[model samples]
Target: MDNNAILNVAHLNIKFGGIIALKDINFHVPRASITALIGPNGAGKTTVFNCLTGFYKGGPGSKLTLSSKNKSNNLVEMLGEGFKLQDFINPPAFVKRIYFKMFGGTHLVCRAGLARTFQNNRLFEEMSVVENLLVAQHMSLEKSLLKGVFQTKDYLESQERALDKAHDWLKFFKLDKRANDIAGELPYGEQKRLEIARAMCTSPELLCLDEPAAGLNPAESAELSELIIRLRDEHRISVLIIEHDMHLVMKIADHIVVLNYGEVLFDGTPAEVRNSSKVIDAYLGKE
Candidate 1:
């Protein structure tokens, strides 16, 4: 584990029955930096993101470790796989592991201080824009059903904070004016911003963005690059991004990891990646 890293992936391997999606994938996202994951069309970049975010489980010996605020979580281990021998000795640990295995999903990943946007905008189509942001904050809100129903002072306070935070993100993303509009009706660029804002509402220590600038024009991609830098420089959030836009990636990434066919081909600074013969041959191409 890199002490400077917010997340570390090691010996990661995932197979779909007979087909292996990823094999021995390893990388670390340094804290308060932008790290870009780039690869060819079938390089298994999204598969890595899915495993890191708990959408898919890695095979045996896979370790997805996340460190936040001085605490560490082995995401794969948290999935409640069969109890270990050490767990048998600790009855409490056994019970806890079992509970997570039965009830755990992607929510647990969010709770662990990681948030992400999909390759495609996944806004709540029928919901209002603000509603979309609010929903993303649900896990962090007070969950006392009784207190919520009664709207106790604590509950009310929490709700107020959530709303304020939502609006703050909206303003940051310059979407405040469209707060009341239906999310699905927004233009493509605005929808992209809204989705990133919604992910920010989670107050994550690490943010993962998948193809965020996919449909954006050159100007929009440039703006998105600046926003991503702000998220790291101003907000101190670590970022892991998968993007095909080399210009955006090279401009903003503090570090780069190149994947080719589910394997790490290179891991270095942006300049190193640009100069690497293997990367050029595998993905970047001769230029």
Candidate 2:
């Protein structure tokens, strides 16, 4: 485990009674970089994401560790405030993990400095674009709610900051004009951008994106590649992406990991991954 790695997942093994899902999986997400996880369908990509964000817990010997540079702290120490470390020391089973979210949920994951977007856009359908972004600041904004309700200076400042962050993301994605429109009403490409922007609003140190380029045309995917790069370079966020878009992955990823049957087949730079015969056989598969 690299001490500096923002996320270190090691020895992760999951099973369903008689069937195994993931076996001895291990990976690290470096700070302020883009690492792509690519594989075919049922390759255990989403299962990996679910486990990291606390939606699904692994069976035994599963270790998912997150770190922070501030005071060189471990997020497990401060996050899930008022909750004891014992609670997460041993996570629940796969089914119980789903119910855990209803209480602590992915929002707890967000507060821990990791946030994710689904392969399918998971937005508040009826909420306006900006509203969706604002809602993602659930934890931060809630702390100032009373002041906001009274329009006090502290809350007003907090609200302004949140809105400013939202506007910046919207502008970056070229969707400032659609900020007031209902989220679901937007076209697919714009909706994709919105989803990324919404995740950005949470101020995550590492953003996990699942198949962000799915359904996007070449032009849109190219632009998304640039956006992802900008997120890493400009916004200072590390990215762990599970995407099938090889072109986009090759374009923006600093590191790439190829997964086959829930285990890592290859892990290296874009050039290395692009040139690997093993990856070709397991994932790329004869062009």
The residue ranges of model 2 lying beyond 4 angstroms of the native Cα positions read 69-105, 142-149, 284-287
* C-alpha TM-scores of all predictions: 0.94, 0.86
What digit string (tens of lDDT, one per residue) describes model 2 on residues 1-287?
A: 89778999888777877878889889999999999998878889898888787666665567677775353433322222233355566565433444543465555667778889998889899999999999987666737557757888877787788899889889999999998999999999999999989888888898999999999999999999998998888888999999987888888999987788978888999999878899878754676
Error of 1 at 189 (Å): 0.9
Cα lDDT listed for each candidate: 0.92, 0.81
List clash counts for every candidate, in order.
0, 0
Best by TM-score: 1
Clashes of 1: 0
RMSD of candidates 1 onward, in order: 1.9, 5.0
Pairs clashing within candidate 1: none
